[model samples]
Target chain A: MQILDRFRDPETGRALLARVSALAEQAQEKLGRRVVFMEVCGTHTVAISKAGLRSLLDGKLELRSGPGCPVCVTDYGDIDAMVAFGRLPGVTVGTFGDMVRVPGSQTSLEQEKARGADIRVFYSPADAVKWAEANPDREMVFLGVGFETTAPAIALSVAQARALGLKNYSVFLANKVVPPALHALLVDPELRLDGFILPGHVSAIIGRRAYDFIAEEYGLPSVISGFETLDILDALYNLLRQVLAGEARVENGYTRVVKEAGNLRAQALLDQFFEITDVSWRGFGVIPGSGLQWKPEYRDFDARVRFAPEVAEPRIPKGCRCGDLLKGKLTPRECKLFATACTPTHPVGPCMVSTEGACAAFYQYERRSS
Target chain B: MPTGNKSEDVILLAHGDGGRLTHELVTGLFLRHFENRLLRELTDAAAFPVGEGRMAVTTDSFVIDPPFFPGGDIGKLAVCGTVNDLAVSGAEPRYLTVAFLIEEGFPLADLDRVVASMAQACQEAGVQVVAGDTKVVGRGHLDKIFINTTGVGLIRPDVDLGYHRLAPGDLILVNGNMGDHGMAVLAAREGFGFADQVVSDCVALHRITGRLLDELGRGVRLMRDLTRGGLATSAKEIAVSAGMDIWLSESEIPIGLAVQGAAEMLGVDPLYLANEGKFLAVVAPTEVEKALTLLRADELGREARIIGEVKAGGGNVFLKTALGGTKYLDLLAGAPLPRIC
Candidate 1:
């Protein structure tokens, strides 16, 4: 098996960085200002954090983390439901690794499994189908997690499961959209972000049109970036240049996969199994139409009907400023438990549990970069 | 459905309902696979000798999808995961307690390998399999394989390092690059489907730690492996516990090229991804030169360097970029690489 789907062509990497560095120089010289860009995807958060792109920029340019993590934004209600689903009889709850340790209102999925619930983690919804086929007589419920990029896959899985007539399979849909989140961030009074680095995966699904609001309404210049080190640099360069040039437009630098209209077949498949709903976020609270729900027609595969999770008022641990950190108001180092009481060995929040969190990213790479 | 003597095919609900049938299934099938002391005892809790010294204990759950991943299986991950925990605590990993929940009909051979991997990883970490328990669930009850392992190790009297002991003028050092393990698993899973091969760097770090202990002789004030949350997390943890601030440099951090590539493909950063055989050491600034020199002398620590310093500020971790700017590094506010460690 070939281990590489892609490699860093030094030439391409250098060119991209040079282009970005050039733009940074142009923005710094032209605007006489520090250009700030917000990347709205959790994956982008990892890309930006690891590549040290933020540090490589022209001194005048700054990039900040945004409300990009789907698990970070998933509400306590949804998490509690998933956890409860973990304990259900004859119900094996399949999910992504990101959702396992999230502190639900009652118990986390990890904890529920401790009590012997059937909570399984899957890389994609397709794997869940594999599980269902392997256990024809047993019920397998896969947790539909992630943003637009992941939602389409979940939709496809639900459709496939139905097509295969797997009566024992169900879906716990927690899929969310990127545009609604961008919408909420724009109107958010607490933020003063200058521009947006739109998530490449989400952009690939909803396309650049989804972020039109950021440019048209909020006057924030947005650029779509790939996950590569140079890709982010280019996004930074593009975003900074636009701010300097006094323009707000959506630009897609990841042309390989993302399209203006995105995958229509994927859109049709998504509408087939799930519908949008006003949902809650982990740190930022609720945003209207930001979440996906299994349609009533597919209630046979809906775990919520067969199972309802018990929940409580989700409270951030005392002195744990994760909520604020999610808004990019505080960095991971600012947390009282960053390296001490809260660590990979003993984490208190989802940010620590998932390696892609901003705090973890900074610690491993940037903590010593300077 | 066939009527006469239906053999085991799919899973049964009885396997997971915590009933008598579930117990029988586990005892009848799984208990015979490994006859270790832990398996023989078969209790909810595992108790073992605790030397007359401070102990480091860690608990982690395995919830990775595919239930199994490439490079290493869940069992190997389970043992290494906890051994690394105790190892980074500066404790010679001593023992492990394992618990398993098998979905009905998981192949007996796969279970054997999972168990064997756990044993092999433990032997490499110089840890004993003290005790374990198992449960089985009926059809659709649980993932194919989920293993939770808890570890305990005794810290040597000569060594002293804890988060609370962090000082204002300590240097932060990283053993290697971050995010290889997490990205490896993610890319290996169904999502990315990249033709590129990314395997989990899931290995025990105790041997590497032993090497560092021999070389640096007590200069180590704090040791934490960059695992679930990556390096920034441990630094922030130190700052918060010691009621001090952290000052780090980004250019000094070490990262793998493949990991870098994987993160780019996934739109994720290698920093926040998880690492298995890596650690972040905080030592006295006076010893920074000695530590860096000594660390570079070793193969494991060759990629090692002094990345940052502990500061007097209260509870804020600041990063001064190579380009001369400062940004606050904070805790994971959300999921970065979930279930990675």
Candidate 2:
């Protein structure tokens, strides 16, 4: 009635948490086994860590961070290529912030900048076209990076860039689709996850049907959680109840935004300029057909096979815990140099560099209590 | 010598691009509103240091749509944002690590130019990038390039900053205005051009912060850079965490005329807007003058002033408006502006 203001719903959040916590406890007893739920969204990792919600959970139920952090999963070779490419003459690279802090073999984008490289962080994929139109001399590259949630926009941008006939522009796509990554995580013996807190934002586009594979094939339970604390708790509670009932299915806890089929228009937009292909994830290694590559029809914007990035697998630094951190095997504090040498200031690995990284989430939010 | 005139039709990918377009976008449409010496350096890196001490490090990843806008582009904002987070925590920014998440087919030239902007920012802030990484997703998998900067700064011995330090009667002081960054970004992203420019107030606060630390010392109780949640949310957090009441004069809160106008037009509250470069420092009333003096002497804090004070018993945040009305600034439970906002 009052537009559902949070100011008015203050107690609702508290009440929701209490109710869900009680339900979770009951479900925990009913399920009869120790259950672990993984939040696959980078935002969920941050929200969970920052709110100290993980520590608040009772012993029976555990929350794990997944590969939802796009920044944390980007490989070392790719980071070097982006920085090295940014250093190229007559080129300008536009990108998001998560890619800026990953450790490369020789230099990072920050180091490349020190050596006079031009690496710009764009808020959107379309911004590159804006820059291209304004300056007709230099070629512009949108260093596209993210999962399906952000992939559609870049697709639209590539379409727009092509339609506009801006020959001085292209995209260095680092896009990963969610379904394969989810499938990969399920098969990963290293990850013994019991349930999943699906990303609400991603679900809104990919639809609830996207996760049906996880439930039907793997028998893993899932609940789409929002960014809010109460929403997340509620999602956990639903997931726990599902497990207690011996059920495996996808349930949407965030009914406020996400729909069963997802944003149709956005899906169509993605279908226009990009196609799913097997791609590489830095920490998880290569996933067969887990990425979105430029459609050959739009090869003009394709840089790797087109421009031939000076890409090489740069050897990671010795003792960096980035690999283990991304797999959820180790916390940021578990890294050899986490606090001693690797800090938000002096990060030793890509995990520490990314704010969305499990290591960064652990260091920023969890380690204070640890 | 000009490609085209500045107009607010739409922002393209090239604006985040480091080519001639980016230069024109900044100089033509954005820089004039919030010009200063630090911003004028126009280098690819910024560098600064702490004499000697144990260091604390922090890094943040940034992704915003329509990268180039009224106040600042993603490049400048990224560098300043990383630096300020370290600065407010009483850290001397020494080194930074950056990574890139690039899309397939992205032009290499643009990457080089943005790197130059990042280098310029680092040089202005007196910090260096020691290491980094990069990765490429398929064409449809990402927006463009995502930059994550991991910064390391040395912590000073005299200052021990955490959430615990707060006492009744402590005064609250903010450098310059609120909501400028949020409003400017929003205006440009939404294509809402204004007669008067509403540029982002993004800058590295460490310069002024260092001066305050040197001048006021332990007299400063607590300090934090209010970003996405703005002053209201951060103050509420402090009040609830410290178990103290925060009372303030809404009139005393500084707001650029254009920022206030934009907020009013968009039906957004200035208190809830994000700030990239500003800070909220809790100072004892007695030390307020010294803090103000130190802040004002620095170009970044030229508009510094005392706006509020800490109180006991309330455990809530209330403000006295210019019209003498009391209003509670509550947290916006939902996303206010959606993605890139």
Candidate 3:
């Protein structure tokens, strides 16, 4: 906690911003335009907005929020399936609280729960497994949705259920990996990017070395950053410094928590019961090898197979530009539905529904910037 | 409504049927703890004397899960919530009317504990229960219990507080820490393992409000209890009401370390979390020091600080970020749900 206090100290934050401002000047002068950077994690999007960094930097640097929010990027078809599972009899839908109010084609878990469906919010997948164990007569389906940071724990739950031979416990897999989505974002010619402020937690699991391709192949400056005001400023400074020095490399700014190789044990756990597969993101349709699926031997623990919910046709709300916003092609305010039709209460898109979503962070913290 | 338990320890539907059991439960239990002249008359309405002054009446309901929490229970919250509402409006809290909705199978001992907590809080706040009602539904019809409290307070002729009295350059002062009650309740309800560390700051705020209004008078422009939507939301409402901007310093806002840590882990901002005992007092800039001194004298306001100031602008609330940036704080858009990733 003492260490965290330093990260939030106003004096330290001011010093870091001063250095970042000077480097940003040099980078912008050399580039003959704004020094654009994308923070490629939902948490970074929220942290940057909450700290009001975008308004502080203003014209010096353009920080675009990328496709990082797992909940926002979840395909509508998957949400519909989860909602369908909630309506199924003798089945209890267990999920993180974030997924409850997210709208599907017909309804949400919240509405289903209100209408006599058994939908429960659990803090962890292990708790859902425990609930399933206690109620053997009821089938429990845990919604497994997150990035690599949460995948290991969900994998552990699967491993635990398998070890215990719990017949009623299953997981609805909507887990995603980060790298392939980044690859998809980089290939878009319309979306311009010079540097990347990478997600800290995801990098802690996949390691800084995993992003070598961004520097080696794409020749873009990137820094893994923690979710703090000072940490974000330091990352922006380092990325600007790299641009000024004519270097395109991935730097580890969150070295205290992240390492070059990342957590190998967590990676092994993910590999044990899951395999990479193609997944559909809300904005980026289908990104190959970006999602996780149960291994063939662990297929029995998969909710999609156990219940076979009849998913409805995915319906996209009109005027919701979450796809464009997630791809960094448009800002939240750029969308016509942003403050008018799309809000946190009556969200038209997943971006406005999730807390880590770029649209929500902008609406909640920085919309009235001078 | 009978479950065939026939146990004395648990409540049954007959307790609310207004017959023999209902009579015993009220006369034996409620009358003993709430021994006031108005209530002892047993009339349908407990009429009380009032001075020649405007009255402030407010109603609030408490349906908190785990009716018992770290610092207080639903019963205590029921009293404090209504009392603070009237007190912040520059009124002297006097009488309260309580209504309880209990599930049939709720334990009698837990109900007694809750009632005892309410009685103690009422004594501390110097309020009496003038009228009351109790009802019990089927086991599944309601949660364990819910309490609604209505408070009536008298405002002295000289006391007038409202957003209309606010102006530019006014200072914003909070009594103490923000987000304690909301975070504590969340931790307790979810069994988040931090319940022991983050205790709720639930108590009556009438003492602090009464002192400020008495000593400072018009120097205190407005006072609002930070209940739902926490400090940020209340500040935003004040800005909108006053048609002026409010600029808050992020560094000056008081948030306890444990609540801050819990908020970070849950991915919810403490700014939008709820508070029970804390409130925002918009005061004239000249009286800011005196107000702080008075607040600090009380144990509840010991951590009080000048968090922000009113500015000349259109209706909006902004926070000067700790890192030297400006961010807008809108009314909390939705429930502050924990983040998934």
CA shift of B266, model 3, Å: 0.6
Local distance difference test scores for all models: 0.72, 0.73, 0.90
For residues A236-336, write the lDDT of model 2, one tens digit per residue: 77887787788998998888889989999989878887888877786678899888888788887887765786777678788886766656665565677
The best candidate by lDDT is 3
- Per residue, candidate 3 scores C-alpha lDDT tens digits across A35-119 of 8898889998988888888998998888888888888898999999998998898999999888888887777787889999999
lDDT of 3 at A5: 89
> How large is the interface RMSD of candidate 1?
7.7
Interface RMSD of each: 7.7, 12.6, 2.1
- lDDT, candidate 1, B91-137, per-residue tens: 88887777887776676556767777776787777787766666667
What ranking of all candidate models by lDDT puts the best one first?
3, 2, 1
For each prediction in turn, the share of the native Cα contacts (below 8 Å between chains A and B) that it retains comes to 0.14, 0.01, 0.77
Residue lDDT tens for model 1, A185-232? 677788777788778777777776767777888888888887766566
True contacts kept of 3: 0.77
TM-score of each: 0.60, 0.60, 0.98
**What lDDT would candidate 3 get against the real structure?**
0.90
Chain A vs. true chain A, TM-score per model, equals 0.89, 0.92, 0.97
- The segments of candidate 1 whose C-alpha lies over 4 angstroms from its true place after superposition are A1-33, A136-138, A334-342, A368-370, B1-341
TM-score between model 2 and native: 0.60
Q: Clashes per prediction?
A: 65, 123, 0
Question: Between prediction 1 and prediction 3, which has the larger DockQ?
Answer: 3
Q: Return the lDDT, model 2, position B183.
A: 81
